[model samples]
Target chain A: MNIELRLFARYREATGVDHERICSAAETISELREVLLARGDHWLVLADERLCCARNQTLCSLDSALCDGDEVALFPPMTGG
Target chain B: MATYITNEAIAAGQRLDALAPSHAAGAVVSFTGYVRDHNLGEAVSTLYLEHYPGMTERALAALEIDAYARWPLLAVDIIHRVGELTLGDVIVFVAVASAHRQAAFEAASYLMDQLKTHIPLWKRECHTASTTPVWLIPH
Candidate 1:
């Protein structure tokens, strides 16, 4: 399955890219993070337990399942007013 | 009820007036958040805000709906500004109207708190005087 990964804030800065299209066999967000983390230290931002995840723009747990073509966003906690 | 996330400056007075009570409502409360000149001892020159387009609106509308379910609110309006902002710029505005002051005040507070950490917006501050900029997350 292929999923669109979106990065925001410091996560984007660290990754040096705002978005990416990844073809993966991972089924859940946690598994997806592990696959990305295998790349290198630049992907270490995903290691932060405080980091937040959203599946298709709605907040979801890391265990949330993913489908092909789903949009997944990863970022630090929100700081809006 | 109306919720907006825009890159343009917000007109607080006009928004407040639009939410003005028509009949039984007796109180209207509002809260505005501003960008400070400094953060954690660093002199900030500018703050840039970003959000997830479709998700941001959905989160905000969910917040508004939550507020209505928790209080006796007659009306509600939330306006949040994104893009580049300088010191003293208004970053957000929240208003709530109800038949009494308590409900209005409480609902306004609830909306602001939820918007702070629940919304998808992110803020990054640049300090021209310093060598590096800072990216801040919700506390």
Candidate 2:
């Protein structure tokens, strides 16, 4: 399935890209993280347990399911007021 | 009724005036979050805010609705600024109107608390005087 990955804040800074298209067979966010982690060290930030994940704009756990065409956002803990 | 995410500067006074009592509203409470000069011993030259476009509005609207559900509020306004900002710049504005001061104050506080930890917004701080900019994850 092809999914849209959205990166924000530091993640975007480290990767130098805000969005990307990834083809993955993973079913859950955790598995998706593994697919991303296989890329390289720059992707290691997603390994941080403190990292937050959102599936389709709503906060979701790593175990949350992913579907084709889903929009997944990854970012650090929110610090906005 | 205006819950917004903009790159423009916010006028707190004007917003408050707009929410001023027209009938039975006896209290108005507001909170403005400003970009501070320093954080964790670093002198921040600028701050950048980012948000999930479609999701940000939905999350903020949900928060506002939640606040109204918890209190007898007559009105609520939330304005969050994105893009680049400098020290002391207004980052966000939250205002609540109620028939009593207690409800207005509590609702405003609740909105801010929820916004900080729950909203989709993220903050990045730059200290150009020294090292590279860093993203700050609030605990």
Give the number of the best model, judged by DockQ: 1
What is chain B's TM-score across the candidates, in the order shown? Answer: 0.94, 0.95
* Candidate 1: residue pairs that collide: none
Off by over 4 Å in 1: none
lDDT of 1 at A11: 91
lDDT of 2 by residue, B22-114 (tens): 688999999999998888888889999988899899999888889989999999999999999998889999999999999999999999998
Native-interface RMSD of candidate 1? 0.9
What lDDT tens digits, residue by residue, belong to model 1 across residues B1-139?
5898999888888888889758888999999888888888888899999898889999999898999999989999999999999988889999999999999999998898898899999988998787677888555
TM-score of 1: 0.95
Model 1 chain B poorest 10 in a row by lDDT: B130-139
DockQ of each: 0.86, 0.85
Where does candidate 2 stray beyond 4 Å? none
